[model samples]
Target: MSTTEQLELDPAEVQAFAGRAVADAATWMATTMTMFGDRLGLWRALADSRPVTSPELAARTGTDERYLREWLAAMTAHGYLTHDPGAGTYLLPPAHVPVLATESPAHIGGLHQALYGLTGMLDRVLAVFRTGGGVPINAYPRDWFEGLERFSAGWFDHLLPQVWLPTLPELEAALRRGADVADIGCGRGRALIRLAERYPAGRYTGFDVHPESIAAAEAAARAAGVADRVRFECLDVSGGLPGDYDVITTFDVVHDAADPRGILAAIHAALRPDGRYLCLDINSSHRLEDNRGPVAAYFYGVSVLYCMTTSLAHGGAGLGTCGFPEHTARELCTAAGFGTVRRVEMENPFNILYEITH
Candidate 1:
């Protein structure tokens, strides 16, 4: 067979693969449009699932009717909205409200906004890929942090109080009776603030290396009226965390640590003998091939763009996003002198909660 003929086989497969690739590109465009709708409050306008003409939607959202028409047409085509061409009206399906409009667990608005932040770092990440350096946390924009907070809000609001604490009855009792709590690597102090609100008797201190995050946490604490019981400090805990905490918690912090082992050790040291340490890290497989589906894809993508890069920039082990899986976590905890490391049974796709003790 000629070389050209050998290479030119499987035209059907090539076309099919190209179609899938084109669909993937269209998904990105859809995400951008979704972001636009979110920013414009178009989703909120149609949150009641009301069918409205382009002019009516424009009146409600203060958007250009022509742009709204195009967006409505696109979203309708994408099956997120229903169109009544006979009446020249469009409506957001009621079922889509939670996923499209509100700040629920199902909402993707934060994810969309976060893409803005991540895509902004594409050039820097590309350069890092070539130069063998990594992007630092400070290089990321405010939108990144804000979007992350929004994305994680549901967990702090619902899961912590209802599911996580209730499941840990002993810790729940300790918190109720005014336990000394420390949230290391606390971002914007959401978890601690939520804790303070729920358990007013508890004294909470939050520590982070990011000065801006510390400030934001403090401000958030004040706004939540938990400032009296909650305090935030800007500190690097990789060296060691200083405190005799009855309950120490780290939310999605370990995988991105510059010194994961050192931080784990510090956590063990800082906790009182009877103290309990609650760690929430990524829920992933230790093996590369075992990690399948969209969540895993997102983990690897984020690992490259943000988590791993930032850690490496700080001269860390750079375990990447999926670094600390269950086995690795248990090993590290055992190495850190944590006598007991019990994995909390949480029905979550993205996180694993560990209840550790000395």
Candidate 2:
């Protein structure tokens, strides 16, 4: 379909779309700051741990009671905070605090904070599209990188335990049967290090475009004492994957490419005849305007926006305004000469893992 056709709308549909747009904009603005407020302990103070009044919470936190009360009331209206009509007070339930509070490093607070930094890249989106180039990884502020580390650490933790751990035994079995693995666009080499540490018998290599990420991955491999087993190289898989391996993995990297096709084709070329390619990417299926609900829409929108801008700055292909869907990605992989693509649930809700074999 043409872009104009996709955007064409009837009068009522246009009104509904405009209304949704306004609500969406307002929703993102509010939720983007929800984590910051929570990290500052505002949510916990109003939570049901104690039966304190707004003034009491304000005094304890050394904040203004008037503003705090208003914020709490806003949360209550948004269903994040429950309002007790009989008690005539606002409250955050125990269940809500973990997600909101930054104390549980296992919680999503770290990821949310990282996302806040990425959203700052929106200003560069147009420039990137115009130039057909992308910003270097080092171009981001230092705090943004720190925020990314915070997010990546927790993300890796979840992935290893939930997806990789369960699959490791199977992966180990595959390796025991003699599988060589390549991690394409493997930033920081966390996945390669973990695999090499666990399955020393398997040959492993980490490949990425960013020299800094490769350096970091190399250091991590050395620190983990797996440098002999795993190797890191500063190469752009987007150009063409160089070596053939029995098994290949690209985690959370393909979606960031401006030309995902080029990367996928290269991956296809680099796979051994009967080798498997595991791809983990963001879930774009849950992004329908109606089904997405408020908070999810905010996160997904920002994520899509970030992917668009970051792709531009990096001088690769851009995802444009819309993030690619799993089906579209699967089709692209197939077109690149892979067969039998399938999606499996990953440990993280944000990702879907694909098992594609050549």
Candidate 3:
């Protein structure tokens, strides 16, 4: 055989490749179905419930039986639900309730919704790939912001006060004593509001470049009866922060900034001499080889579709999602005039918390 003919793919290898491709397609479809279930309250209805026929689940959720039947089949086939062939019913197992129910911290339904929204930006993202720029934050679908709010709620609600704050004893003490605090890139202002509610004496300010997010944060503060203590402003800290604060926080914010160093510098300047700086960002490796796994894949995907693109739109350095790992974080903090950078001993799958001091 000629050299070119000999290089042809073996039948077994071709079959394996095809099988992998099919499996990936199935996984994609499963994710779509997961989002559908989340949006329609199907998962919520199934949680903690006994095995039921599709018609029964449909009736409970006020959805069409035909659609429910297909959805249930898809969920079962994808192992999201357990199928009882003998009883002709389906159920979300007790073990899976935490992963499906919104009330549970382990629920991942928000991520499914967020991914669905991110996929909608593919057309614009494709243009950026061909051209040399990216889509702006405002150009994305409104659902993207809404989905992000949902996806991040669990962290702020469950982890912030209970798990994360206790890890920083000094910061926690200051918060209780009514320290002036500021949260940069405070999307929707939930974190500040939560803090304000817990530490009623503490005054809080939140800043975000997005006006809509600022407005939403304001509304949330009002609704939570913390507006007097927690106020949000639409400001780009890349220029500089206006007020000195006892504590400043940036939650998954730096990587998306047009000028991360400038933001860090601003934070350094805005903090009091003995103030604390809390940074909650993605946990990944500075080296690409060490950043393998599903989490890394998710971060990279989001970086391309959202984080990196938003920065590029602002003519930024575009650090991307996994840009600031522990090493880079320490380096940036040091350059920004912070004297110390300590990684807090808080274990979280999606984020790493840092306590920085000058």
In candidate 3, where is summed lDDT lowest over 10 consecutive residues?
Answer: 101-110
lDDT of each: 0.89, 0.69, 0.90
Candidate 1 C-alpha lDDT tens digits along 201-271: 99999999888889999999999999999999998887787768999999999999889998998888889
In model 3, what lDDT does residue 118 have?
85
lDDT of 3 by residue, 1-358 (tens): 8896879768998899999889988988998999899989999998875899988888999999998999999999989899999998999988888888656678787777778788889999999999978889888766777778877888889999999899899999999999999999998888899899899999999999888888999999999999899988899988889879999999999988989999999999999998999999999889999889778988998999999999998899899999999999999999999999999886677899999999
What is the alpha-carbon lDDT for the whole of candidate 2? Answer: 0.69
Query: What TM-score quantifies how close candidate 1 is to the native fold?
Result: 0.96
TM-score versus the correct structure, for each prediction? 0.96, 0.68, 0.95
lDDT for each residue of candidate 2 in 186-290, tens digit (9 for 90 to 100):
877877777776668888988877677788888888999988778988887777876688889887777677678888898889888877787777666624663
Model 3 sits at a Cα RMSD from the real structure of 1.9
lDDT of candidate model 1 versus the reference: 0.89
- The best candidate by TM-score is 1
lDDT (Cα, 0-100) at 23 in candidate 2: 84
Clashing pairs in 3: none
Off by over 4 Å in 1: 1-9
Q: What C-alpha lDDT, on a 0 to 100 scale, does residue 37 get in candidate 2?
A: 64
Model 1: clashing residue pairs? Answer: none
